[model samples]
Target: MPMAADEIVSLIVAGIPDAQVEMTDLAGDNNHWAARVVSESFRGLPRLKQQRAVYAALGDKMGGVLHALQLTTAVPVQE
Candidate 1:
């Protein structure tokens, strides 16, 4: 079964405690999702590292349950 967007968001938030996650189904299918994650942990991290962190949160589900994820990670924008 395909992973739900909420499930993916929950996993990311669980791993990154203070993350703000917004998940959208880009193709209207659960398999293809776009996620915007804002976290303090991404403050100084490079883009690749930030993506890796999010992927790590999903563990081994990458190739199985979760098909593809379009992720954007950023530190919360300062006012």
Candidate 2:
């Protein structure tokens, strides 16, 4: 089964309470997703750790239900 974009966003939000997530289905199959997450939580974290947080949010779904995912994460810029 494929995961819905909402479910993915919800899971990310569930873990990173202050995150802003944008999801796109690269394959139009709902299984291949490209997520752009902007969060204050990532401010000082390394790129690998930032991605890890989002991946952790998804848990086991990463390989089983989600199939493929491309993620980009960034910290919010100060104005």
Candidate 3:
């Protein structure tokens, strides 16, 4: 079964409370998704670490229920 977009957002928000997540259905199928996550907590963290955090939030769902994900992470700009 494919995962719901809200489920992905909820998991990320649950793990990283300050994260702002935007999800897109890349292939018009729930199985393929693109997620852009922006968070103040990501400041000073390496991009690899930031990506890892998001993946960690998704847990084992990445390969099983969720299928493919194109992820982008960023720190919120201070203006």
* Better candidate number, 1 or 3, judged by TM-score: 3
Candidates in descending lDDT order: 3, 2, 1
lDDT of each: 0.87, 0.93, 0.93
RMSD of 2: 0.7
Residue range 1-79, candidate 1, lDDT tens digits: 8899888878988888998999999888678888999998998889999989998988888878888888888999889
> Against the true structure, what is each candidate's TM-score?
0.92, 0.95, 0.96
- What is the Å distance of residue 55 in model 1 from its true position? 0.7
Please, what are the lDDT tens digits per residue for candidate 3 over residues 1-79?
A: 8898999999999989999999999988787999999999899999999999999999888888987999999999888
Pairs that collide, model 1: none
Candidate 3 is scored at a TM of: 0.96
Pitting candidate 1 against candidate 3, the one with the higher lDDT is 3
Q: Candidate 1 at 63: error in angstroms? A: 1.8
Best by the TM-score measure = 3
RMSD values, in order shown: 0.9, 0.7, 0.7
